[model samples]
Target chain A: MKLFSLEYGLFLLSVFYIFYLLPHRHQWKLLLAASLGFYMITVPLYVVVPFTICMVSYVAGLLIENTGRNEWKKAIFIMSLMVNIGILIFFKYVDFLTKSFFMALGALQSHFFQGSAFIAAPSPFNILVPLGISYITFQGIGYTIEIYRGNHRAEKNMGLFFTYLMFFPKIYSGPIERAHHFLPQLHERKTLDYELVSDGLKLIVWGLFKKLIIAERLSKVIDIVFQNPDHYAGIPLIFASVIFLVQLYADFSGYTDIAIGSANVLGFKLTANFNFPLIARSTTELWRRWHISLSTWFFEYVYNPIAIAKREWNQWAVIYASLVTFLILGLWHGASWKFVVFGLLQGVVLSAEFLTKKFRKIISSKLPEVVNNCIGVMFTVLFFSFSLLFFKAGNFSDAAMMARHYFIFTGDESRIYSLFQAFKLSGVLKLTFLAGLLLAVEYLDRNFDLKKVISRQAVVLRWLIYYMVIFAILTFGKFQQEQFIYFKF
Target chain B: MTDADVLKQVNEIFIDVLDNESIVLKRETVAKDVEEWDSLTHIQLIVTVEKHFKIKFTAAEILKFRDVGHFCDEIIRKLGAS
Candidate 1:
């Protein structure tokens, strides 16, 4: 069930009710059943994919922990990695691989044999990848890696291990909880805390506001422009590109908020996935703040080993590792060449930033502090927005067209007016205002815990603020229920 | 070498690799406490420490070190073992 739906709300309510009714020790049993039930209901037959991962990872963790011989442990680790990664690659990329193979063969035939009879491309099987397979695979692998590294002990309890992997709240899109962070919590005796639950409810409301009010409203316009880049250019295209970036952030972060909030209500703390990434002054800094869980995952597992192994190459090791890690990260996003280009663009920019650190520092020092900060924010935002075109486009050619058209500023002010007309004036104005308000609050929240500040306010004011938020959401929020953008990854 | 000696050496390596002479490391110091000691510079410091001590660390050992003190203790333990 979609997390935002009435059914999911009822389901969570039922689970939460039974969850606390059960004894603390038996709570895991309820969670395990709920997780499995949730997954089964969400993807029916494809539940086997995550079930298989949990089994493999569970057995591998025990095997790695029990094995004394380093070589045996290493062998088991490699095999487990291969199995998890293999499953991910097969389901995610087989179609892309098949299409590319046939295209290459067709090109070779036309060059050598004059296309004696042009080979027709076969129809795709259109395999349905399991929901949250990427998150599942990464979660399983992260757990196994921790065990293999001797950083954490393997849980002997199969039920708890399964529950850890299949936890319903985060099973869809994860902050990718680490074994060490999440496992111990299962054993704790959780007493219902009214304050924590209230906080969680507020967070859920805030998440709903972002998704429905801002993201969905903007998505209507962004989708139109992105779907037909050739239909319009200049200002409309530029406007969509800039706001599509924002829409993506709102949608994905909104989902993350709900995931984390639900977990909090259940007395489980999932890792925070975002910090206000919009204000980041550099692409490198942006990554450190954005999609923090995944970025940390890559840094910990992928970048560290590669960089350390090639440390004899000095700074070249860092550069090489950054490129390879981001490339893999790009491929991890989807089975498209456009994603590869998007990822490489990030890699190239990061590498250049690293190489020019001294020069940039000198230049920035020459400017006023406020001016320097403004310039840095603008550059990072534009760079990110440009790269996102590649990520958003249907294919490489579409992305290239959008990029080419971006620079053609038709000097037509009507283009903006037409966009406003298409979006409807009130909708566009609401989106603009909400987007700004979200950024301003995020900036302030970073310096001070705004939630805590609100909690300390008079009961009347607090409730009034909450009511206003709920009122705004109900009145202005889109009910179309767009799926979260990161769900595909 | 004693743990204190190893800590001293590690501090120097951090200063050199990060190119920040003002970096002062304590037993409780973590990566975030030092401005330049990020994941990228972290590897540089680790490699520098290995080269300076003529010792190597396994991936597991590197990953397991919780803080500067844990790191120094591991280095001293390795030195004593050798």
Candidate 2:
């Protein structure tokens, strides 16, 4: 079931009521059932596959934890990793592999592949994507790693462990909650607090506004321009590129808000997945702010390990580590070559920043603070937008054509204006207002909670602002249900 | 190799590596405390510490050190508990 749908809302309400009303000792069972119910609602048949895998992994983790022999522990850990990754690769990469293999055979002109005889043979089975498989797979892997590393004690209770992995609120797009933060909460007795509920509702409302009013609206234009880049070149493409930045932020951050807010209502605080990424003046700063959870996850688990593997390699090793991590990150998004290029572009930009640090320090000292800040922000936005072409394009050729048009600036400006007009000025104005609203809210909430700030205002002012926000969302919000952008990952 | 001496040396290295002259190190000081003490420059700190202390730390030990105090203690202990 969709997280924001009415049916899902009713399901959540029922789960919440029963969750608290159940005996404290039996709460884990309730959560486990709710999680199974949640997954079953989406993928009824394939639901058992992940559940069974998780159960086996849970048992294996307990075996590893209880085993006295170091060799036995290592064996168990490897087995767990192999199983998790095997499932992930089979589902995510089999098609890519099969396609590549046939293409290779075609290039070689293999006799077996003649007339599409062997190569075009249908697969024995159709692969069905389990809902939220990537998320739960990562969670399971992290749990096994933590157990192997002795960072966390394995949960003896199978129900609690299963519930921890399949928490419905975070099963799709996630903050990628770590064992340290999430597992402890599963064991705690949750007490309902009015403030928590109010804050959570506010967050959920804000998330809906971001998704419905801002992201979905912007997506309409972005999808249009990106789908037919040749038809709308230059300024139109540029505008769409900029809108993409907004769309990405709103879509992913909106999902995170819903996830965190839902969990918060149950007294489990999921990690904050974003900061004010748009305010970042540099690529590095942008990484720090955007997708904070995934970035930190990669840093801790992937980058740090590669970096520390060879101390003698020093700064070069660090740079290479960053590059490799980002490359892996890009691959993690999808098996597409476009994602590979996108990841490499980001890695190149970040690596350049590192390599030029000394030169920048010498030159930057002469520039005024305002000039530097402006230059930094411009460079960041321009580079970010350029890289996103890969993300937006249908293929490498499409991305190249868009890039060419972007730099040539040879498209008809009048045509761009007409195209904008075709979209309706009212839609454009609504989008602009939504963007402005997000910026204003982010500006105010840069340091502290905007809702809390509003709550503390004069009663009349507070009510006015609240009503205005609600009215704007209800009136201007895009009502078409669009899947979150990150759900594809 | 006293705690004070280690702190002083680490502080100087932090200032030099980060190019922030007014850096002050405390027990709880972390990489985030310095502007330029990013992942790249972090290796510079470790290398500099190794040279100064005449010791080496395993990757696992390095990863486990939470803050400057732990790092300093580990370095000191690695250098034959001087």
Candidate 3:
């Protein structure tokens, strides 16, 4: 079920009522049941996939923890990793792998015996990849690794572990909560807090405004230009590409806000996934802010180990590790070359930033502080927005086509005219105004507690502001029930 | 060497690697306390500390340091063992 839908609202309402009615000790059981019900409702038969992986990791964790011999612990660790990773590969990458294999074979056959149909193209394996398999398996793998590393003890309670993996709020698209951080919270007794619930409700409304009013409306404009890249060029293509990045940020961060807000209402805290990534002054800072959980996951698990092992290579070690880590991170997004390119662009930019750190600092020192900040923000936004062309495109070639068409502007009124013709001028202005309002709110929110400020105001004034927000959402919010973009990952 | 001496030496390494002589590290200081000490610079710090102290750290050990105090404690323990 869609998190933004009425059905989910009803479901959450039922759970909220029953949840507080139960004793704190039994709260976990209700959460587990709710998670299982959510999974079954959403993906039906594929519920077994996460269950099987969770079972493997759970058993593997116990075995590794119990084993005294280092060799035995290592064996169990590798075996469990293989089982978890193997299942993920089969489910997520089978089609991509099969297609690549068939293409290679076709090329080989043509080279050997002249061009022909070459035994007919194999039908695509239209596999039903289980929802949240990437996230679920990664969490499981992270848990097992932590246990094996002795960083954390294996949870004896199977139910709690399962609940951690399948927790309804974050399972769909994750803040990929680590076992060490999350398991301890599950053990705590939580009482209802008015502040927590109030904050959560505010967050939910804010998330809805971002997703419906900003992201959904922006996606409509992006779709026209991106879906038919051949029909448009110049300013329109650039506008669509830049807006696609904003749309993605709104949609994904909106989903995260709702996920975190819902979990908070239940007295469970998930990690904050975004930190105003658009304002990041550099690529390195951007990664730190954007998809924080995923980037940190890769940094901790993937990058650190590789960097440490190859430390003898000095800065080159970091460069190599970063590239490999981002490549894998990209593949984690999708089993496609386009995602790989998207990831490589980030890695390359990050490496460039790293290499030129001293030089850039020197240059910034020479420039006025305002000029430096402006240049940094402009460069970061332009580079990141353009790179997302790879992410938004249907495939690799389309992305390349868009990139090429970005610079091919016709010096005519038609180019600007086509964009206006495609999207109404008044609608564009409204979205622009809304986007500007979002930025202003975010900037203010970053510096101060917006909620607290609003609360401290006079009752009438506070209610007026609240009603205005509610009215804006009610009037402008698109109730199209558009799926969050990150859900596909 | 005393823990104070170890902290002093580690402070020098941080200043040298990060290119900021004005950096001040306390026992409770964490990576977030220092603007330059990100994940990338973190490896550089580790490498520099290892080289300066002539000690090796396992991946887990490297990752386990919660703060500057823990880092200093590890160095002291390694020095005593050696």
Candidate 4:
């Protein structure tokens, strides 16, 4: 279910009230039952797949824990990993792989047979992907991997492991909770604190404003340009590309805010996934701030192992690790060549940064810190925005055309005139006003901690502001259901 | 070997790998204290230390060394054990 939907709102209200009345010990059972109900609500048949995965992983964890210092535990861990990964690959990538293989074979055959074409019908056995399969699957594997590494002891209780896996707030799109950090907090007594609740409510409101008001509004403008870039020229495409970045950031991060806030309201603190990535001064810094949980996961599980394995290669090992890790990470988004290209772009940039770190440091040290930071921020955002060409494009040709035309100096000489031509005064002005307002809020929040200041404000003033915000949401919010961009991943 | 002797050797390795003769090491030094000592250099430093000391570290042990002091302690303990 969509977090912003009326159904979810009503469901949460009922759950919150019921949760409020429950004693601490029984809360896990309620959550597990509610999680089952939530999955059943999304897709009834697919519940079997995720439930089976959780139960299998739970058994694997138990088997690993009991067979200490035995070879069977290693075999069991490998078996569990294979089952989880095999399911993901079969469901997500099999078709992509099959099509790709045929396309390659067709290309080779074309050279031998003059009139031959590579054409094959797609497979008929269509499988419906479960909503939170990747997330839960990763958590399940991470649990067993931790057990194998001796970093974590397996959870003895079956229900608790299921509760940990199916924590519904983070189920669909995740902060990808670790078993060690998250499992301990599940059993703690959670009496509602009014301050925490208010903070949670504020975060939810802010997240909604970003999604409904900013991202949705921006999506309309971006769709016009991206859907048919042939109709548009340089500045319009450029504007759309920049706006798409904002829209995506707002969309994904907005979802995260609501997830974290909802968890916070229930006295469960999920880890943050984003941290003002747009303002980051370098690609490395940007990655550290953007989708932090996923990046950390790859760093821990993928990159570190590869680098450690190839430690003798010095800098080459790091380069190899960065490329492989990011390539896999990109493929994780979806089964598409475009996503591969997107991942490659990031990998190449990171690899280059590793090679040129000292040189860049010397150059950066020459400039004043503030000036250096500004230039760094500009380059980082521009580089990222440019690479997203593959991510937003229809196919390689359109993306190539966009990139080919990105440097065109002839089309619409004045950038200002082009923007005016592309957007209506009201549309442009409204976007500018809202964007400026958002920047103000972000600035205050980042620099001075806006939440703390808000807490200190007079009660009447606070209520007035709250009412005004509610009125604004009613007046200007987008009412249509727009799925979050990360849901497919 | 003494802490000072290991520190001197580490300083030499840092200088050799980073190609900067002016580099020095301190007990308090962390990754951020040296611009050249990123993740790539980090593993190289560890592997070099392992080769130099003729000892191996588990992944967890390698991860436990938060700074030069922690690293020195691990190296000393391993040397004493050997």
The candidate scoring highest on TM-score is: 3
Per-model TM-score (chain A alone) = 0.95, 0.92, 0.96, 0.95
Q: What is the lDDT of residue B2 in candidate 2?
A: 84
Kindly give the stretch of ten consecutive residues in candidate 4 chain A with the minimal lDDT sum.
A409-418
lDDT tens digits by residue: candidate 2, A87-148:
88788777766776766777666655554544463463447767677778887887888788
lDDT of 2: 0.80
Candidate 3 lDDT, A1-489, residue by residue in tens: 888877887888888889889997898899999999998996689999999999999999999999999999999999999999999999989888888887888898899878775476668778888999999999999999889888899999999999999999899999899987788889888788889988887888788888988888888877988888777778877777778778888899988988988888888889899999989999899999999999998998899999988887878888988899989988888989899998998889888888888889888889998899889988998889888988989999999888888878775422888888888798678667766777888888888979899999999999898888879888988876668888888
TM-score of chain B of 1: 0.95
Clashing pairs in 3: none
DockQ of each: 0.60, 0.63, 0.63, 0.46
Sorting all predicted structures by lDDT, with the top scorer first, yields: 3, 1, 4, 2
Residues A1-489 of candidate 1: C-alpha lDDT, one tens digit per residue: 777777877888898788888899899999999999999985688889998899999999999999999999999999999999989988998888788888898999889998864787788768888988999899899999989888789999999999998999899889888888899999898778888777787778878888888888878778877888776667777777878888888888888888888888888888999989998888988898889999999999898889878888877888899999999988889998898888888888988887787678779878999999898888898889989999999889999988888877665532777677667788678668767887887777789888899999999999999999989988888766767889888
Report the Cα interface RMSD of each model, rounded to 1 decimal: 1.5, 1.5, 1.0, 2.4
TM-score of 4: 0.92
Q: Model 3 RMSD to the real structure?
A: 1.9
Q: Which ten residues in a row have the lowest lDDT in candidate 2 chain A?
A: A117-126
Give model 4's DockQ, 2 decimals.
0.46
As a whole number from 0 to 100, the lDDT of residue A286 in candidate 3 is 92
Per-prediction tally of clashes: 0, 0, 0, 0
Off by over 4 Å in 3: A108-121, A410-415
What's the TM-score of each model vs. the native? 0.94, 0.93, 0.96, 0.92
Q: In candidate 3, how many Å is residue A434 off?
A: 2.1
What's the DockQ of model 1? 0.60
The best candidate by lDDT is 3
As a whole number from 0 to 100, the lDDT of residue B14 in candidate 3 is 93
Model 1 pairs in collision: none
